[model samples]
Target: MSDVRTPTALPTTTIGPADEPATVGAIGYGAMSIAGTYGAIADADVTAVLDASIEAGANLIDTANVYGDGRSEQLLGRYLAGRRDDVVLASKVGIVNGGGIGKRGIRGDRAYIHEQIDLSLGRLGTDHLDLYYQHRVDPNIPIEETVGALAELVTAGKIRRIGLSEATGDELRRAHAVHPIAAIQSEWSIVSRDIETYVVPTAAELGVTVVAFSPLSRGLFTDSFGPEDVHLGGTRANFPRFQPEHLGANLELAAHFRSLAHRLGTTSEALAIAWVHDRAEQLGARVVSIPGTRSVAHLHANFEALQLELSDETRAEIDGYAARVSGPRASDPNWVSGGREGLI
Candidate 1:
């Protein structure tokens, strides 16, 4: 294991659990990467990464039940045993795996919600989760019914706060009316800015924090991968942005941003994370970025974003570069949710 560097002072943001608030670092650790979604990660390496994250002051660790068919939560459960109190543990439900591997189905019915929470708790080795989210809105079940079930969990002390992922503006409002939402997790990055137009404003108005996942744009914003590196097995392979046809254009856009990062004396990954954080600050909405990685070095590089400050002019340049990106954020139509017409 490598030595963990001293992390810079991270800004604080308060997320709501109705009247209650939980203050956590603005940057968090996304656990999906370690679930072997991209590639296999050693158990020891996963433990080391979690240790380094805690050492670097990233106390919010986010994972989902559907990730690796509950493998992610199980891994966190084993690693977080002694240090559980030191972190804000969050896990999501609603998306259930289909009969075939990689096939998935969403379920937000009252019974499914009741059963999944207990299963998540058991797999996580915790009596209560600091924050719980509905991974995807189920089109069959009403949002009110799902939120009502989540509110029951709070009353039962199964989860401290409630969150919704890929929820639309109207769905968010309706859910909030049933129970206050603590956070809204979505794919928001320099390359993917679809959520900013409406989701950000709705969350800001409802006093809900926006938790930005894939802040690195599925590693497209990083220097490690390029157009030639797109493979057929991993998560990125299925993303439209990473398809061979569109990847070259995306890489061209990324190259421009990479040059800007070089001139700014920072890594492109760090700059990408900083851009998301800075944009949220400018919008006057609380945003926490959970950038996931399997490598300790990459994790450290991401944390460096906390120390890099982007000027207004540089931010504009990055924004302009992002506008040039080609292809949809994800290849699967189901992956693109949270819009008015798409909300479940």
Candidate 2:
């Protein structure tokens, strides 16, 4: 589908469990938090985390071309430089040319996408990327044009698989028509359930996996946020929910989730991850979760989430916390994502 140059061999790794656990991972790493935000991470640190993830049994790594203006991929490339056969190396294009603060634009025109594949391959130091996604849908460009171009990548062997991020159901169908979307990367945590109404079902019918990002509610579900936790060195600082006034209210809601977890004999983080997996499955969707973290211990904790299963009554309890509230996801509409009318 895309003529973007690809690596010679495909990585033989999968992110989900063999049985499709109620939650996606047995263990997955979030390289973003450790290295810093979507910006700079030293090659040494990236090398270390890559080692840690494999030791922890994580087979996948998620990153974007705009991360550290491609520094994240560079680090990952260096880490995976020689071990290419061992992991599922996933990266994206479209969200490019961001400022130092991680503010960037999404461009998915065919020509731009072709050039981006080359750039991502160069930064990632791979010929054939296992999975490639449109980091953000460009509103100015049609979804078909963007996905059609991606489909060509699949045909050309540049990208073994294709996915879309921040797309609506209609957009997904338009894209899938041109190519089979292996996944749709969107914020599908317990808090961000908008995809439930349409996107999830649409993806299910197409047999495309829902690659849920931010499954931890940006660490709010960990029962770790405090008044002092505000303004940490990442996008959470600018998020509306992390604002001083909303922090307490949001944490209160998070505490309710935590309380339910306690009654169920699990941590709130595990409960949150389980709920996302179950929610999509109830609707017949296949989910692949990537909750980014710098710590392997936390990665193990997240892996434990796979063992969690709530009955209908308990599912309702968890759903109650999310259904009743509308919290701040972004500080401004501009950075919220997908930048399309009525999509967010």
Give the best candidate by lDDT: 1
Give candidate 2's error at residue 288 in angstroms. Answer: 0.7
Best by TM-score: 1
Q: Per-residue lDDT of 1-344 in model 1, one digit per residue for the tens?
A: 21123455776777776468887888899999888887789998998898888877788999988888889999999988877898999999888887533377889988888898999899889999989999888988899999999999999999999999988777889999998999999998887777777788899888899999999888888877776556623667777788788888988888887887887778889889988988888887899999998888998899888877677678767777656888777555555553444531
Q: For model 2, how does the per-residue alpha-carbon lDDT over 176-292 read when each residue is reduced to its tens digit?
A: 887677778887777777777778888888777788888987888884555564555556766667767677788788778778777777777777887777787699877767787
How far does residue 280 in candidate 2 sit from its true spot (Å)? 1.9
Per-residue error for 322 in candidate 1, Å, reads 3.7
How many clashes in each candidate?
0, 13
The runs of at least 3 residues in candidate 1 whose Cα sits more than 4 Å from the true structure, single-residue gaps closed, are: 1-7, 99-103, 338-344
> Pairing residues by index, what is the TM-score of model 2?
0.85
